[model samples]
Target: MRNSDPTLPPGAPPAAGAYTVPRTDPATPDGVGAVPGPSAAPDRVHAVASPPLVTHRECPAPHVLPGCAQSDGLSPASRYGELFVDVQHSGLFADSKTFPDCIPNCDPELIVTRYREQRATPGFSLADFVQAHFTRASVPESHYVSDPASTLHAHIESLWPVLTRKPMAHPPRSSLLPLPHRYVVPGGRFGELYYWDSYFTMLGLAGSGCGDLLLEMVQNFAYLLDTYGLVPNGTRNYYLSRSQPPVFILMVDLLEREQVARAIDFLPQLRREYAFWMDGAQGLRPGHAHRRAICLADGVVLNRYWDDRCCPREEAFLEDMQTAMYSGRPHHAVFRDLRAAAESGWDFSSRWLDTPAAAQPANLGTIRTTAMLPVDLNALLWHLETRLAELCDQAGDADAGDYRAAAQRRKEAIMQTMWDDAAGAFVDYDWCRGEPRRCLTAATVMPLFLGLAQPAQAQAVAQAIAARLLDQGGLATTELTSGQQWDHPNGWAPMQWLAVRGLARYGHDTLAREIAQRWLATVASLYTHECKLVEKYRIEPCGEHAKGGGGGEYPLQDGFGWTNAVASALMALYGDVAATCRVDVGDADSGGQPGHPLS
Candidate 1:
């Protein structure tokens, strides 16, 4: 039996103050070469020099160090030892300068001791370690770092708290679950594989412990933005002309929390992505006088989900009908008219779709011709503006302050413009038409979440929501009469979470718990039955078929990411009241003398 080769199986550890290397070949004779022989060893034997240090820059990919590859022909133990030695001497250690004369040959056990000590050192966070090692070679503009070792460490650190708490599991249900057919609709493949859905899913992935998946989703969205200047609703060619709601800002916010430096580095890209959403409004003239910036002549300022080019025959006919009916001209007469029918929070309304001759006279005037400004869209934009300003500030841009001020002004405007004094709810505004739409939709509650509503207004909106929108499981997107799956009857996980959060923000803890508990119970029931979370659920107790009955696009989607994320967040909230309080609305009293505040 021979002594293990330091570079073969049981490699010699780094000199003192290094990570320990484990032995792979314990079968080898431990003392074969312990004694010196007359011919085999000289009176003064010299130890072989350890492998040379590989600098971080030179190592290329430190996570997959050269020593680990079997192609290198080194035993596992020897490879690990060499890797440890390399890490120690490569100046990757927390305080390399302090251990300048540290030996390169020590026992594996001693190396482990040094590793532990370095980890315990203050100010040596795992994030710092990853930044030191991972090189962002793929996305130069995005500046994404890719040190797996560091990434893994950071992930464990961030996720440990949540994992240890272990939120409640989903409630049991039947194994057989019903699904809709539209989910698997043929030829419905849109561009880029459901772009909007993917964005929401990425949020869940980030919130959950799937960092790698989250990063991939981000990269995918970035690729879309880079390739097309915006992310389309789907990956398919037919969907290329139109994009979904502006969610890029939200995604950036999520990414920023995880890696602020990298997110800041991509500020320019974020700016560009924001431009895509506001492209239509960039140079538009005001529809109404005294309105700061008019998106419609009547007075509305809301945007619609749209694609400007490549209109399909079905869509072309619809546009032509709308144009002839409303303006008695082509739909392309102005940006506002084309967007009018779509401005309503009620997606795909029959009133908007019906030709002028066929439309009800009452619905025909300014509201039909004027684009409607949605409470949710404006609120989301306000937040986006605020976030963008913060990002700009972080990047040392001079315009950040101005951007923040503009956002605040916009927040005030949205509150003033959309709040309905008579309806007891925040209503959608047909800015061009000069009146409120007065319909109850989940979008109404957005002002509460944005903190744009006055306390009275928020409380009223919360009460209205509790009275009309809140169902057994969660808040419905809209009243049942709308007949739009995206609006009524269907309770989406993301929307439910938003409602729960919005209510909690307004100090409506009981209402928040009511929605949260019901939603969680539904999720658990579904999870128990299907063993996976779903995208949305039917709050009407009619089961999946009832919800699936009225649909246009595809059948209801399942295995959703946002749903899972919301579930996780709600579970976290339920388990810890202290955590919930962080998001709770403070002592802002509801305005006095209210049937409901908005009213």
Candidate 2:
């Protein structure tokens, strides 16, 4: 994997351990009391403060949110519009997400009317106005602590209730789109149920004997499909304009394996989701794009991340606005790209940057998510197509053939456009640039994991995994550290699981086990002291110094649903949680060579 040169703005924390975790005790140092392995040390609490917020573009002084001025020609069409863009711009809450997530005490129109009434008055206070008109959002919190001696598996079991959200009887008007059944959130600042996150979280839920929640979560998504044209990025009104990576099919597959779900029952929902993604495919002309569907020059249809709305993300309004200001591009264009990246579930990664391998952290403004047809996303759609075929055939429907033909065309297109023989793996194709995005990410193994790759292709992908993507702790998200959560040194639960399952599918058991072992070790090492699971981990610098991964809008979060679930699932599949094989991970960096995953 190529190293990244981060070009972060002033006051932005570089990815140089910007997130600090306390070093554990010397006596029990290498502390893995919960699940012991080599260099299994616990980190003291993460103490590195988040970088100070900086609105990159200098707003005109005293203009009441200088970025909100109409002089820039950015007429954001948000219902909030210029009316209450002021609340976010005022920066009342430390986290920019706070204001958008707040439930209004009365109608939003009344709040706007009140704001207008009070705004021009001398000594008018935006903070006071907000306090009177809205209720602050409540971030989910857990005070439950695990016993120090409990195994990682047991701790995970105890955490299920903590992460689970019960159905609300009477919910307030907020960003959340309430579902009938209870579902799991990814935890921390992410308190809402995410579209793609539930699939990986289900792995742990199933292993910990919480399959009931898994079933309910799947049902909830189906319900969402029935209500909305497609499952939005998450269960939030703010997310209604976008959808995350379509993992709903995989979620149903997991339920089927448990012998509880029948794919035929979900045929309608499945078809609807596929239709949602392929909305503009049939009508698109060669070399044109619409929404999420991109048409190649060969007239082949593929998918790219996109959003229906072209405005700043409600949850990330301030940050998005700042990025647009810094981009030197039209605000609407940059806003669309930012939302599209969020829809990809890799909100910020070098993979979408103009110069992905730039020496310094590349400017956030360069992200062009809609320009690239991602290999993993297309592979997922292929699985969805094939699944639709199977279910349709099971129901004796004639459309099965249509789905099957679609699957074949998609697979062939993927191989022709995305497979880079020189890179020994599949890569994303930038349709706008007419080039390949060669950033080596753990996503390269998606085709193999889904059983969509030929033997030679799988072999080449496995070699690529061993040679570049692997690290001492586990597979890094990508080789570049661009101060993005989805970039280098950070290993996410979904990525690690995909690599492990994919490698093992191709009969590379040794490499699979090694990757799984290192990830489990890294997770369990922190579990000993923190007694908690985090959203992501620092896998590259794998030693006592290892801790939760950082770099993004939010701080490292605990009660992390996917991490807990993936950790438990890995323990069940690879080994007992109480016993992990010791791998010397601290000094095990390997240059691009076909070697051990944890070497």
Candidate 3:
């Protein structure tokens, strides 16, 4: 049925490349242990354009991946040194990722030597030197035809080639890590495969019947694991300091289900990613934390978002540096917290900040992401633990029991610590304060989505979602309107999928269907207007009132991967709402805007 007339037609035009649009994780099983390239099929790529002559970051991923393992071990600071500092501080580019992503005019070694020689000269200008040395990073321009009247489905299907970066044998000496096959980017400024974003993107890819491209993405992730030990935030050296979230296991699950294959082939890389997160867990003491793992006072071990470096993020250098300057806390501590927030994916939210009230705004400087153990993160890890047990059982591995026991232990820890009976919802545990943060957010739905919540817990969380989090269009990310993209009014595609799927899993079908329909209506209203997809939506309003999302490190990104994918996947699950949406969003009772649209 899917193949007969697939959304992405097989006979679609062989890509001469499409036109540009408007610009805008692995983890291990549950364990309390302390911390710590693709081996893929021979699907090779032809060398495309010759490697651009340029100065590159020190950790240049080799043409062949295995040789690049050492690159992951070194910090960008050590590799790029003062040269990295100058480019970021001198403000040569608006986006911090720009300079690092650019190809150089000559060899990196020569550039660095010349930088030292000329930096102190009377007429030396950091900006001029950078301009002379680095070529501007490649920006995708429009080549694909855009039919304004085309249905959103048609538009998304047409995007596959536009978003796909061609396969390459040799990569330019830029910050980008090389991949063995052609892969799709999320669109706009993001030009590489991401860690967790792939799962939801894969869902859309699956629904669209873009099977070959989807599998290529999974293999690319495996390649990252083999080459870099873990998938960095994105396929770039600068992002090596942190990862988005530990959803690599979920991605693997997608593969196994689609391919009807065993998980053993990827077991090594799976375990390796798990070990990376648990690297410092072995020796961690109660009431202590190490790397991404935390040991509560009661000896329950859980995870938190973290970054290895206690410095500014290369992609967010200016903003991170400004946040540190304003933060009353130590600069190092601020940088770490900022990076940790980035890892949480809700980069700036009341969930991570020291806010006065759930709905009140907070300054970015008040972020304390590393100090809290998120309920969604713990639930995700629990999913990993249980899945690992199942996979081990499938392969007849003896350690399945260890993983099963670990999952049970984590479930108990989550119920005892993360569940707040008074709040009637699961909340993040602020280990530092020894209490639940009690910030109501879409994250409460994760437990249900992953089947970690008991029936009673699911009921309570569902009630909370309906009473607080659900807005006019879909689920608001958090209760607060903190001038952050992830907060009130804006809803992200991934969060909507999590809520809709989780609610349905818990038998809250009415709420789930309403959410799905309303969200589709909102997206339809926009696509009808802008003819483009975006990273997030202003879902606190009705379909007609919905607007483009804002308030983040960058502008609203178009040609969005997850948004397009979630749209396709959701339509596949729930019948396509194109006709219904064109008529009306839903009945009035679905969701009428309240005074504040809080939560």
Candidate 4:
């Protein structure tokens, strides 16, 4: 099982500081290894066999003088090389994307020392050092800056040009973390392609006649799947240990309109992605579990969000350290919560809290996300399975039979395990307690969105949403006021889209349209005041919370990608002559027609 040679194959260790993905053979049966069997520990860990050892002592940049005094303990790459991470945690650099890349051919310590020395000298400013040593990623001012004149449609149209990243160079350099094909980034703090965010962004691109970009993004995802076994959370080395929600199947479905014939071409990658999620699934037996999979008392298998590395996130390093310090729990347990939160994409929600007493509610150490079968995660996998079966049927692949059978079993397990008969909703299942979490969040609508709910079930879910979750502005993430971005009063773009679409699917168009209109109006109101779209909004009646929908690590960000895209889509669907009249201008020069019906 062990090999000294670095290049033997993936799953075997590579050179000390290199990364290798465990590739699965497409033609082989049991291509991806199964989850451990009944005797294995239920809380077993599954991680990269040998992750690259990134340390300050072994700096990759060659400019550091060997045996120099500064080289004794300093890692420039750790401190200054990743400007994105530094600025995010710094609180000094307010704008995430406006910072310069690392200064080439210079030691980080020497640069910092010299910059300080220059500042002490007469008339010497930080800008002088920046001019001498660094280059800006782009001219932020030349690009569209937020302004009062900008409408949501205008901002979105402007973003298509600014956020679209071109393909990377061939035989990508070792230092490069870029993807091989063009893709759009969520704006402001996020300057790279994200896994789940891309799908929502594509919806706007497709509706706006930018289907070409949609195809290119899908091509990028395929490239990642082929190269890395699974797409990293983002196109970054730090994100390799875990992935966000699997939305590649949905991305492929969105692009099928233009390339329907090539739809089956993505099946191989789709199968591999499924294998990654279900890596431990096949070995499940009664009363046993493994990474990402577990067995219920009745022997049904289900999924949960998991991360291989149980540690603090690199981007929010200091915040995580402080949280762990105050958590009064073992460091290992805190790490699991942090990683599980990342996998959920609701990094710090009350949905993950383990106990009612728990010493304190905000104590992140109480997070038990790994011990719960998330409703949204399972529903997403169900969609993927259903899609795989359809594509297999089209291509006449023999795997069609297996996929259809898997989809059916998953649908049955979801209904039996997640359904809350009295609550009239689908709730996240706590594997430890063997009962529903009963949060009544926006995730309940996921089954409806996927068309997996019976008519009665869908009706109940809709009623639950209206009764507990929905507000005047739109749907809240959950009923709690935990000061987390994913909790109450902080309605997000993706959740709103899910709730609206899910309601519409179950013959509740009137309610769906009402929610959509209200959300769109909220967006308009926020834009009118701030002159920019944001990541999340205070969807409560404005006076409920102290600062309104604010929480999480940072302040509300603008140049928002998903918000603009989702708003554009909803406005197109619901905007009438009266709504169109509300727009400041008839149309803008950038091919932006704010009130025009989507083609």
Candidate 5:
């Protein structure tokens, strides 16, 4: 079998202890490699070297080698995190539920010694050493069926215990700070409290009357903001460099609606999170960029997704390394690709790439995520700012003025920078290229969702979406069929929800109901066959047999958090297909209307 990096010399062996992928069917997923040779087994291989000695430069931040003056003692969980990165070099855990828990339970030095001894013994295997010295937690079983009538509700109820985890055991602290309470994970391979996913999961939780769990999840996010300065994408140390979407404000807003008294309590965290996204805003001058916010040519600051670190992500270390090798770009640029993708929360989507659809072989290096100010992210921030202003008003605090002014500036900036008047839709601004990206994406509806768009603009956006973006399944993420999961033929629950609500806000009732019904039917039809809700759906309505949504770095995942939440919310709001179709979707309530004064 050939080595993983095609760029290497024809017969050159892989780097010491690097993952050596055996040849496999080209059609398979990127992370799934061919089985390794016996002597090059995963258990025997370290992440980057034969013995994998920890160097001051290579260790995860805050835990450089002991000799380094700034280094701190590596916690047991972090040690396990590093080990998990090493022992599972062949992407063993990339698609597994228990992979997240593959943290270190034994001494790192002893494990390294055992690895060396095993490699020295001609017939010995490193897998045997892992069996003797390490332990992995089992995935909790499910008690649901494929019957559509009851399956969705059944899985939501039954998976509570399966999805919920107690605080980390003491001996091995979680790579992250321990959670204050039990929380529901999104299940499948995602075994942590993902930032954006949790908000949607709470929808199902709230629908099922799991209010305590909902509150606990919000508290957990609050805890994250207090400790990490920003919520890491998920509750893992490795995800610390970036966050998913800034959905914490929405989560807290939901809590406020449910239990009005809690609103004031969460205000401080909301402000802190806003500060995290706008970290470098105060210093921004014309035509410069800061962490997440960029000053446009017009001197209006807008936001884009970015990560602080420019290195291979720990969880997808091997995949990122291989992508870098094939990218024909510098290592840091590829790292930016991976990080920027994470920031967008649509990892590996062509929406972030600079190349055209005709560009062959997926040059991920063309990804310029830091240089594109996405419409959805800015709209979400506008929502956050609006909400903060409301909270300040309710509490009689003067900061409401500041938040309102911030929101107004962002709203005007979005209108000026994102709206494509000729196309009658919003588009992402390629700051690096100084032009609108020209691709229409579901992200355009975000302004409508957050009540940021003016009435005429909202109507134009709705027309553009219905004319070119809507599909049989509901809504394609983008108008292009780029083989990336976030593009054509695929529709995700969150976008469906936002687009549906956004349309309704503008009194596009018939269109809004049509979208909601189509999405619900897709979910129902799939449930009848698969009996499970997946992370994404094939909504293109081609004559092909329905299969799992394909593309992206991983397989279609079930135990989907946002899917359940959005479906549950839609089901509650618009019940059966007949009723949903008949319902008149008018303007959203006065509070939900767009173009209202900030908050």
Candidate 6:
């Protein structure tokens, strides 16, 4: 069926053949389109019917320019311009010229080439270069040229030219390839990674002017939705069973801002992606309390990370191993363990073992359930639902109103069930025990990101976070003394960025600035020391005796993707923090007293 309405947005290209929109009556029973409420509707949800698929070109080889022709009349600026001209012109011709023949013996190329080649040759020393470059001459007493501080500054100023002269070579822009695997767990031995996490990481990339990479990531997710019903936790065959949080709607928003037509081209994919998340609850369990169209028992929604095919429970490890082969060439065992750790999210808990009450045998086989629905996951899904409803409305779909209503209902359910009055923060429920887990993990602050917390609640959570979980650098994933790596004394880049943004959103400028500055400094310090972004950092002070430990089925892991991406985004945000800090600070500032129930 064809959509007769020309104003309706085009859907995703048809599965195998030409793309077509399924026709539905605008005024029929199945067409319950929601009216736009007071909130201003987006101008146009779908921008283009179909955008051309992206294409990549191979990077051209570097062209070596002929040495500059030395002329006595040429000034330094003119000489530099001449060199640049030569470099540009070299691309037209393939022949090479010797340095001395093309230019004078004192040509800059001679200096550069000699320096690099000498550095590359074994034992061809830089000791003489360092001494000559840094040493200062002693000034006579009458010269007035050597005030100690002034002299130091002068020396630094002089070094700048020499330092800048040796141009650092950047990787050919094209050679800096995107990771073939979208989501990478540097320490997670699992070869495949997750979907939603990649979306957040891609956001950081988009903000950093890596729009091409961001587009690739979005296309990847769209491909997954088209090929499979939904994107699984990762691309690996083993990860087909479960998914992480839903953030594809946010990804579409990013793409739309980049170019509207691009998003419209992918609308059908977006619709199906939403369908996958809403599948189980689409009238299947209408009696559920949280009448958001999707329902999970006990008001909990969203799936925890699971890899049913390969992840082994304690009781079935031997049996599972016999059938499930490990991905070959394991460079890091810790990463494999980390991947397994994601499965239960109860890092190091003994409950995963096959105790009578702990283990349950199901269709996938025997597995243990930690039975906690994370607050952050649900909050993210709620955000997705709202965005989806807006998309539907913009597309002129009749069911848009129902989606909006459902989202509002879910938001209310989340606030009622997850917000802990005694804890003064949002907490995840341990479903088995029917109680909130009072641990102070960074997930507690996620409600602020979702705008789920009230002004007072936001303030209390921020203050409590600063008091208990925050360190000199950033908020720890958990309280440091907890012994669980994921729990405490460890600070992750994503969580730190989230907290900084969350606090800023609530008008905690002073606290937010401190956290942002500390984390940025730590990241900068690490980058300076290592010349690379790392996955995670140990913010805990070292004890007299260095402790070696294990958590969950694996050792603590680091050098993560979400970490690097978040750190880069945070650094970018640092420039504008002071200006935006005052936007959200309000009457809640007074609510942040010391004893305000942060659990």
Best by lDDT: 2
RMSD of each: 26.3, 13.8, 12.3, 12.0, 8.8, 21.5
Arranged by lDDT, best first: 2, 3, 5, 4, 1, 6
Per-residue C-alpha lDDT of model 2 across residues 142-245, encoded as one tens digit per residue = 43567888887888888888778866622455556667778888877777889888888888878766777878999989877776667878776667667888
Per candidate, the number of residue pairs that clash is 25, 10, 25, 1, 3, 16
Q: Tell me the lDDT of model 4 at 322.
A: 46
RMSD of 2: 13.8
Using all chains and alpha carbons, the TM-scores for the candidates as numbered come to 0.55, 0.84, 0.84, 0.76, 0.81, 0.55
Which prediction has more favorable lDDT, 1 or 4? 4
Deviation from native of the Cα of residue 134 in model 3, angstroms: 0.9
lDDT, candidate 1, 361-403, per-residue tens:
2222122322445667677777777878998888889979976
**Cα shift from native, residue 181, model 4 (Å):** 1.8
In model 4, the Cα lDDT at residue 293 comes to 73
Q: Between candidates 1 and 6, which one is better according to lDDT?
A: 1
Model 5 CA lDDT for position 533:
75
Q: In order, what lDDT does every prediction score?
A: 0.45, 0.71, 0.70, 0.64, 0.66, 0.44
Off by over 4 Å in 6: 1-193, 258-265, 282-370, 480-483, 543-560, 575-599
In candidate 2, which residue pairs get closer than 3 Å at backbone N, Cα or C atoms, i.e. clash? 5-359, 5-360, 5-361, 6-360, 6-361, 7-360, 7-361, 22-44, 31-41, 588-599
Pick the TM-score winner.
2
How much is 2 displaced in model 5, in angstroms? 15
